[model samples]
Target chain A: MNKHLTVALDAMGGDEAPAIVVHGAEIARERFPEARFLFFGRESEIKPLLDASPALAQVSTLIHTDDVVSSEDKPARALRRGRKSSMALAIEAVKAGDADVAVSAGNTGALMALAKFILRTLPSIDRPALASLLPTYKGECVMLDLGANVECDASNLVEFSVMGAAFARTVLGLQRPKLSLLNIGVEELKGNEEVKEAAEILRNSDLPLEFAGFIEGDMIGAGSADVVVTDGFTGNVALKTAEGTARLIGSLVRDAFQSSTRAKLGYLMARRGLDGLRSHLDPNNHNGAVMLGLNGLVVKSHGGASISGFATAIGVAIDMARHNLIHLITQDLGGVFMGQSVEDEAPLSNPDKEASSR
Target chain B: MNKHLTVALDAMGGDEAPAIVVHGAEIARERFPEARFLFFGRESEIKPLLDASPALAQVSTLIHTDDVVSSEDKPARALRRGRKSSMALAIEAVKAGDADVAVSAGNTGALMALAKFILRTLPSIDRPALASLLPTYKGECVMLDLGANVECDASNLVEFSVMGAAFARTVLGLQRPKLSLLNIGVEELKGNEEVKEAAEILRNSDLPLEFAGFIEGDMIGAGSADVVVTDGFTGNVALKTAEGTARLIGSLVRDAFQSSTRAKLGYLMARRGLDGLRSHLDPNNHNGAVMLGLNGLVVKSHGGASISGFATAIGVAIDMARHNLIHLITQDLGGVFMGQSVEDEAPLSNPDKEASSR
Candidate 1:
């Protein structure tokens, strides 16, 4: 029996695809000698990296797919029309029991739409949300629904709070993560009706979550909450604003270092501290977008990501798989069903059927 | 001949209150010996700062005002019943021809309402707006309607653009200030209906504003626009978020410094750079809130300001007075009414009549 960890890698995706995707698979095979990659893209594009993999030197079974997904393709339409797209085929690898997880850097919307159509959301989840870890002053904080679902209802936000809390615990190893509803203000009735209602629901919820009050964009980096949930519009804006601000601040620091001769010397002497700041603010250390709440594991890397960035994302998927995070989330969602009947329980996709079928 | 430059300061306003207010008045008096300030509050509270000010040894006429407005007081209610409040009386001092400027660190809404009600807005301006200078990565950006009006029409935003442009020229010395309407996205038709329509109006307007297009919240600090205009709610949230972010970032740096001995030494070495940042982000230096579209001068300090903060706001008032900023703004506003009839061109205020009355 081969002790292999197989990953279905979407080769024809992202800003620099086939190259970085195949390169990342090659790097991972080096770490896990028994690891196998089922590359999903055209043979002409991925043949170089596939041929370079020592284990696949003479193996015809190594490259499992030869399809490509175009980023410009409309998500829902692409899912229906492009059944053999690289992303679609990669996702199918999980369904066919040929891969432990599927990974992509393709159009996020297409991935999410196709994933839902192919894999099907767990029993209780209406939609699979994207969860990403943010670098906070206190280690890290997890935020969800990054840009998955823009228009959200109060119940959706409440469900996000539950899902995000579970994610932080599984990923960051935090116990009973502090959760907050992201809003412009902290008052109970501060936001739109949905948000205000969500606040009320969270307050009354006994989901084992530390119901921290509303966390503003500024307090996001200050450890106000271990987990934060908001509609995709606000969350995406906040995330991009934070990213843009960090870059702006980093650039400003560089300018300040060269502003005056004295300041330059001052910065030189304090190079260690400044370097620490630069490291702290760098997004690479905290890079990769995680798409959670799906039936199977999937991670989205940045379009301009390098092989190393893809490797980090692959590592995240491996860790998430090792812990059976999505399944664990299904089980832990018990907290949210405390007073509710079976009908009110959030849906969960059973992984046991997937395992037995595999 | 007495060169009494009467100033009515809200003595019972802000957290620091009479202490900072009195200290600032004393400093202003010492700095400009010819200037006289009539502190408005109950005589009992005003007497102590008066006793402290050697220059104000003769403190006889105190207007007998006894009320003080609290932050929790509603804006409209404060404007109504606060007729006897210290801030109300302070503005009344100007209306009564006993003061040149009225400054307060009370509730911003109440200040704008009272300021507009008492001193009146400049002709052709329907609503008065609060403007503040924000620190941009490249330079300074001035924004209007910080919290004065929650909902603004396209015309109001346009007027804000004109007033802000004049303000940047006079206060920041920017010749042709670039103006941007804050929006959800950069596209002309992307933002809210108001913003989309505002962009159209601005694109077609004859105002001398260098309408640079829509700007997001993140770019506000990048000097993307020399002047930014938005509804009060979003603008206030952005302002507060920026202030809070700076504070949060500073705290994070302080903690990073104490993390290890190496970090401590690095921090000590970088103390100068850090200090530069501290001063750079200081709200004190960036204090003074401009009540634009006003006939005379009204400056509202942050409700949480210290004595030095109140003093800084008064300094802005003094500068505006010296520069005849209101008259200049009214004169320059001719651009907005360029092709209007001769009767429409209004002189800001007849200097000869003003002097004779004085």
Candidate 2:
């Protein structure tokens, strides 16, 4: 089954690309030996790196592309002028059925734009959302719309809930994912109109999803829900805030350990356990942000991620393709519950229109 | 200087009220010997606790009241029926000039509602905001609107920036506080309309504030700016997420230390330094979420806060009242830069209306 899977790579993307990309593919190839790859970038730059990885070279095809999308390029500019760029071509591979999934660690805006433009959104999805795994006390949870579609309507939120549930089921291997809307408070009447309306829809809907009601930010780490759905703005802020807090705590821990001679000795004794803790909290262990709602799967690795991180992202793509996440989402969206007329749906662009009408 | 200050206490507020509030007052009294207090709540419950602390009792006057607002009480109900309640009476002390500031660890929604209705808002401010100090690597930063106004316009955010700057100057003791609007991206064109418009106003304004442009959530702990401003919804989520992350990391560290005999020994050796770190990051040490923009000073402590936390909140109230934060904000608002006509101001209620008007 893995032999049929083809992963497309945007080799010219990220801060340290082609080299890290090839090395990471080598690591992924070792773990997923049956998977094949199509590398999209300049042949001169990518060929040498692939040659260094004999095993990766054996299972990969180098698709030459001279044009590259700069990290500084705006999403609009990238879309209009980057038709031949490595990132665009890589996404095209997924659209053309040459690859089961496409992965990039390039400019997030450009990737989202190109992916949305070329692959298009799923029939039931108005816009694609960025979803990533967050390590929670109970295990892990998925949060969506990390930085896509900042202003979302109730219908858009409901769509995100559906997408998040599918993602949790596929990636987290959950029987039935409990989904919650991220809000200022867990109370029914709290938060803005969009969240309240979305909750109302979810609570009343006959969808297969387990509607877990509203959840506060503190509950994200407490593992209150399998999937947390939010507008891009809140999700982005929460995700980054969590990251910043983690980093601050980590530095504080190190500072404490180095404050005294006794603490230095303690550090030596606790080095092994500390290493375990570090690895557990490492972003590389949880790499791969899947852009859900697209017609085809497109996984994004962190631009500054290491070989291990990139390999983890590849693993996510492999799992997603194997599980047929898109198929499951389509099937779920096509169900009897989703056959309700568009009048019940709110346009994400004009959320206030719904508010006024309601 | 504190001789003129009198703090109003909602003696029945908080999870462990009466006992905790009384104890906290004693602690604050010891810290600020010149400060006096007017405690509002049932005299039967508070008299004994105050009697235990003779020093606090000498400086305190008990205002008997049988009514108490429960944590579950809605804001509207709290405002309408809580006139004789402890929380309301405590706020009334500030309004009636009986206290320099009022401190409560009650239901945040109710406190805000009652405070807004009784205290009223400053002429330059359309809505109130919640501000709190967050520990960062470079020391500390002030973030606002923690959860006061759910939805804000561009003008409200600009106002928040002004308020947050004043807060940093007063509490954090910064000479020229660097202020930034919290956004998903730091780019000029990124984020929702409110944030983008707010950025434009700040960039063009001649306010004394060092408008540092947009900052993402991760920068909050990096000390990218002294003041971080955002709408209440996003700010609340980010703040909670940061707190949740901190707790998760703390637990993980403890788990690591207890994993093996060596780590246990390490924990013992590093106890002193770790204690210092703990105190620095402790919520009690940094307690106080001040409701800004109100005519009177009001500090809201966490309902679950300990005596130390409540004492810290009282300290914040004292500092704000002493520094004349509201006076400073009023002066700042009356400056030449704020003379721009109301046509430039965006309406908070109907954000979409502004979208079309522009």
TM-score of chain B of each: 0.89, 0.93
lDDT by residue (B65-132, candidate 1, tens digit) is 77887765655677668988999888888777787888887766567667777788777676667888
| lDDT string, candidate 2, B180-270, tens digits | 9998777775778898899999999877779989898878988889999998889889988888887787788888899999999999999
What's the CA error at residue B77 for candidate 2, in Å? Answer: 2.5
> Which candidate comes out best when scored by lDDT?
2
**Interface residue Cα RMSD of candidate 1 after superposition:** 11.1
DockQ of 1: 0.14
The weakest ten consecutive residues by lDDT in model 1 chain B span: B349-358
Docking class of 1: incorrect
Measured on C-alpha atoms, candidate 2 has an lDDT of 0.84
Residue pairs whose backbone atoms clash in candidate 2: none
lDDT of 1 at A69: 62
Clashes of 1: 8
Residue A22, candidate 1: Cα error in Å is: 5.2
